[model samples]
Target: MTRTFRRGGTGGAGGDLDLYQYAYLAGGGLRVAESAVVSLTERGTLSLGAARLRVTGEERPEHPVELAVVVACPRSKPVREVIESVGHSSEVDVIARRLVSLGLVRRWRRKPTRAGRRRLADAASAGQVPAYALRGPAALVPGSARRGPLDVHPALGDLGRALTRMGKALDDDRGHGTDSSADAGGFGGGGGDW
Candidate 1:
């Protein structure tokens, strides 16, 4: 099984908040393995099965540069640029730290992958804002983020109607003599009444 890690940021004070999503694939298909929100300030190690990792985060001198370094990312880039790729830098750092703590991700001397870089590019292009990306003050609970369910997804609408009809039928069946009397009536009127 393979897993994916990701981060997102929010605006204002506390920097970015980090979050991760893990996907597990088996003979059936793909499914969500695990997901969580993490904090940026911490040092720890993680061990997932045979894999082991260590990570650390500390504030740096260069504003954006420091943030990137704390996340063990090489080179300097704007906060917006970082946010674009991984989400908020702070959030990403927190997630990285969490990975360290959880044993999912660790700090070590290793080269980045083309797939990882591509994932960053996709994150950037998606324009996934920070508010909904992280937890605590920054992250917005997905379901509560908007007013309510859209009820406009076509299939969902149909399902809603079907459920409504089913409910009405259930109510009718559960009622007293009214349903039985109604059923007894034939064509234009009841047999004896006609």
Candidate 2:
């Protein structure tokens, strides 16, 4: 479905996203690489060797991630190297751009847009996401992105706490605010803070 994105870039919810998009949602490009490995292994097109992944079948890859993995495994490369190669390949960029265009992922960063989160939730509920592909820190965090600057920058939460500390340190903790005339050392006075 066609989606029109708002200027702030949290994006609007439209419909379900694909498995690769879901992988991107959970763990960026690395997760996509892991997923391609699992798919290839399950299909018997790829076999794992001693510290390597060897192609056993002549099956042509159809997906970008799959193609990247297959192309990198021409001679049974190390498993780690193969995954890393595909993780950093142009194919991941292509997947990322498609997600960005669909409003499922933000540009530049690997963060899923708000609508993208909904798409992930949809996939989860439908059991479209393979359980083996998601776990640990890379797993999807439930709920919408935090509000305000925190939504745009996860690190901004720390800045917000710092601002609170500044307010408390000024004895403005009582909500006396800038008009308290308590003298904020000229750093936080004049209603500069919200």
Candidate 3:
């Protein structure tokens, strides 16, 4: 399957700033190509084999659940590390289990060594420890050029930004409460209404 996405407009005054894209799947599988490109547009169209797909909606705030998956999707990591990286210990386990059930990740037991057992004695349960590994497709979605331990594909950068924005928004909401009407408008003295 070939996936192409195109985002509309250039960033400038009076130009639309919203981002949009389409992802298509064809013949029940994705193909790897050196020159493959996926373009995303504000009003983009997607074609998958003989089927056409359309996606529409306002982007929702990024949740920890999705962030956890993205963080753990690139490689096999110790369960504790995955939990720590996402900072959602309780939720990460559930998400990992679900991913395993969904066939997106695989879970296995790693027998604890003497040193490992000592290090994790306080943190882990008896016997072997559980670890998770991303399935081929989940890891390959980021492409072959992805680098570093924490790097995600360029295509997923927007999602990372959304997660950051959501964290800031939640922090602000906690500090100032949910009502933001006070800052709804600014400048001039006309009650700040436009």
* Residue 43 accuracy (lDDT) in model 3: 15
Looking at model 3, the pairs that clash are 5-38, 5-39, 5-40, 6-39, 6-40, 6-41, 7-40, 7-41
Quote each prediction's TM-score.
Answer: 0.18, 0.60, 0.18
Candidate 3 displacement at residue 184 in angstroms:
54
Cα lDDT of model 3 overall? Answer: 0.26
Position 57, candidate 3: lDDT: 26
Model 2 lDDT per residue over 3-28, tens place: 11122234335444556667777778
Query: Per-residue lDDT for 64 in model 2?
Result: 68
Question: For candidate 1, lDDT tens digit of each residue in 1-54?
Answer: 112233443331222222232211100000110111112211111111111111
lDDT of model 1 at position 164: 31
> Which candidate has the highest TM-score of all?
2
Q: What's the true lDDT of residue 178 in model 1?
A: 41
Residue range with the least summed lDDT across 10 consecutive positions in model 2: 136-145
Ranking by lDDT: 2, 1, 3
lDDT measured at residue 131 in model 3 versus the true structure, 0 to 100: 13
